[model samples]
Target: MERVVITGMGAVTPIGNDVKTYMDALKAGKCGVAPITHFDTAEFKVKVAAEIKDFDPTQYMDKREAKRMDSFCHYAVAAAAQALEQAGLREPGSFDPWRTGIIFGSGCGGLPIVETEVVRLHEKGPSRVSPLYIPEMIANMAAAHISMQFGIRGESVCPITACATSTHALGEAMRMIRHGYQDIVVAGGTEAAICTIGMAGFQNMKALYTGDDPQAASIPFDKRRSGFVMGEGAGALILESLSHAKARGAHIICEIAGYGATSDAYHITSPDPEGEGACRAMQLAIADAGLTPADVDYINAHGTSTPINEKYETIAIKKAFGDALKSVKVSSTKSMTGHMLGAAGAAEAIACAMAICDGIIPPTINFVEPDEDCDLDVCPNHAVQADVKVAISNSLGFGGHNATVLLKRYE
Candidate 1:
C-alpha cells in the first residue's frame, strides 16, 4: 500500500479560527464556551455553547458567494481554503485537477437554514422559501463546494456519521490515497448546529449541559460533569501520497499510519457499556499501523463530558491498551472547544498530528474533581511538554459509530 501523509491543516473552532490561533489557544488552555449568542436561549434549559465569535464570511469568500452558502458551508470553505493555502497547492496549474479530490463530513448539515425556511413556509407559504434551500441544506454541499472552489475533479464524498463523521472522512481519504484512487485529497468535517431548533432538540434529549458558568461547563473526565456543551466549527486537512508530496516538495506534517471504524449496533444514541466496538476500533487501528499498544505515546480522547461517554471510553481504552494503558497520555480538547459534534474528531485529529510535530500534548481543561473510572493521565488542566512520536485520535458518535485515526511523527 502507498503511504499517506498530511501536508496541511486548517480549523475554524470555538477557541480560534485558524490553525495557529487554535494551537495557541490549546497550549494556553483557553476555553471558548460562553452564553449562546446565536439565538434566544431564555426558554431553553441549555443556555451556553462554544460559538465562533465575530466570524466574517466575507473574509473568505465574496459577499454574493457568502450570502448563498449556509453558515456551515462558510466554515467548511474557509477551513478548506486555509488548508490549501498552507499546502501551497491552491493554484490550478500546480497539480492535475483530476488527481485531486475531497471528502468532507457534517452531522446536521444546515439546521439553522432549514429552521428558518420551514418557518417561512409556515408563515408566508411555500413560495417564500428560497430556491437554494435544498442545495444549501444538504450535507454533501460542503464537499461539493470545496471541489468546485479548487477545481478538484476526482472522487468527492461526504460522510455523515454523527460525531464521528469527520474522522471517518479522514480515514477514508487516507485509504483513497493508499489505494491509488487519488494523489491528493482535501478532507475534514464542518458543523453549525447551535441554532434555535438545534439547541431545543439536544436540550429535549438532555444531551447539553445547563450549567451557568461557561468556563466550567465542559469539564471532561470529571466527577461533576453532567453533560456536553455544544460547539460549532469546521476542521480540514490536506492529505497526499508520500511520492506525490515529495515530488512537489510539500512540507509533510506527519504520516497517517492507520485508520479504523466500527459500529456498536447497540444503541441509537448511547454507547455500549462495555465499549466493545470502541475497543475493537482502537485495536484494529494499532494493528493496521503495524504497531502494538506500547508504541502509542498519546491519545486524543473523545471525552464529551457526558456521563456514559466518559465512563465507557475509559473502559475501551483499558481494553484496547491492556497493560500499556498506563503509559499513554490522554486528553480531551473538547474540554476547551466544547463538543463540536461532527467536526469534533477532525479538529482533534489535527491537534494530534500537531502534537506529533511539536511534541506538546494539549490538555483537558476544567478538570477539577477526578473520577475512579477515568483514571488515566488525562493531562488535566494544563498542557504538557512531551515527546509525542505516535498518537491516536478517537471519535465516537451517536448511533453507535466509532472511529480512530493514527498519526506518526515524520522522520
Candidate 2:
C-alpha cells in the first residue's frame, strides 16, 4: 500500500479561526461556551453553545457567491482554501486535477437553510421559497462545492455519519491515496447547525448542556457532567501520497497509519452500553497500524461530556488496552471547543496532529470531579508536554457509528 501523509491542516473552530489561535486557546484552558447568540433562545431549554464569533463569510467569498451557498458550504470552502494554502497547493491548475479528490463530511448539512425554507413555504406560500434551497440543503453540497472550488474532479464524495462523518471521510480519503487512486485529497468535516430548529431538536433529545455558567457547562469525564455543549465550525486537512509530498518538499505533519470504522447496531441515539463497538474500532485501528496498545501514547477521546458516553468510552478504552490504559494520556479538546457535531472528529484529528508535532497534549478543561466509572487519567485543567510517537483520535456518532484514526509522528 502507498503511504499516506498529512501535509496541511486548517480549522475554523469556536475557540479560534486557525490552528495556531485554536491551539493557543486550548493550551490556555479557555472555554468557548457561551449563551447562544445566533438566534433568540427565549423559548428553548438549552441556550448555550460554542459559536464561531465574528465569522463573516463575505471575507472568504463574494457577496453574490455567499448568498447562493449555505453557511455550511461557506465554512467548508473557507476551510478547504486554508488547508490547500497551507499545503502549498495554491494553483490547482498546476497539478493533475483529475488525480485530486475531495471528501468532506456534514452531519446536518444546511439545516438552518432548510428550516428557513420550510418556514417560508408555510408562511409565504411555495413561491417565496428560494430556488437554490434544494441544492443548498443537500448533505453533499459541502463536498461538491469544495470539488468545484478546487477543480478536483476525482472521487468527490461526502460522508454523513452524524458525528463520525469527518473521521470516516478522512479515513476514506486516506484509503484512496494509499491505494494509488489519488495523489492528493482534501478531506475533513464542516458544520453550521447552531440555529433555532437545530438547537431545539438536540434540546428536546436532552443532548445539550444546560448550565448557565459557560465555564462549567462542558465538563467531560467529570461527575457533574450533564451533556455536551453544541458547537459550530469546520476543520479541513490536506492528505497527500508520501511520494508526492516528498517530491514537492512539503512539510509532513504526520502519517495516516490506520483507520477503523464500526457500527454498534445497538441504538439510534446512544452508544453501546458496554462500549463493545468502540473497543472494536480502537482495536482494529491499532492492529491495522501494526502496533500494540502500548505503542499509543495519547488519545483524543470522543468525550462529549455526557454521562453515558464518558462512562462507556472509559469502559471501551480499558477493554481495548487493558493495563496500557494507565499510561495513555487521554484528553477531550471538546472541553474547550465544545462538540462540533459532525465536524468534531475532524477538529480533534487536527489536535492529534498538532500534539504529535509540538509534543504538547491539549487539556480537558474544567475537570473538577472525576466520575467513578471514568477512572482513566484524563489530562485535566492544563496542557502537558510529552514526547508522543503515536496518537489515536476517536469519534462516535449517533446511530452507534464509530470511527478511529491512527496518526504517527513523521520521522
| RMSD of each predicted structure | 0.7, 0.9
Candidate 1, residue 373: the lDDT equals 89
Candidate 2 Cα errors over 4 Å, as ranges: none
Model 1: per-residue Cα lDDT at residue 105: 92
- The clash number for model 2 is 0
The lDDT of each candidate is: 0.93, 0.91
Each candidate's clash count: 0, 0
- If scored against the real structure, what TM-score would every candidate get? 0.99, 0.99
Candidate 2 lDDT, tens digit per residue, 1-411? 888999888889999988888878877888999888999888888878999987777767788889999888888888888888889986856568888899898999999999999999999999999999999999899999888777888889889999999999889999999999999999999999999999889988989887678988999999999999999899999999999999989989899898899999999999999889999999999998889999999999999999899999998999999988878999999999999988898899999987898999999999999889998888889998989899999999999999999999887
Candidate 1 has what TM-score? 0.99
Pull out the clashing pairs in model 1: none
Best candidate, TM-score: 1
lDDT of 1 by residue, 1-411 (tens): 889999989999999999999999999999999998998877988989999987888888899998889999999999999999999888889888899999999999999999999999999999999999999999999999898888889999999999999999999999999999999999999999999999999988998898779877999999999999999999999999999999999999999989999999999999999999999999989998999999999999999999989999999999999999878999999999999988998899989987888889999998899999889899999999999999999999999999999999876
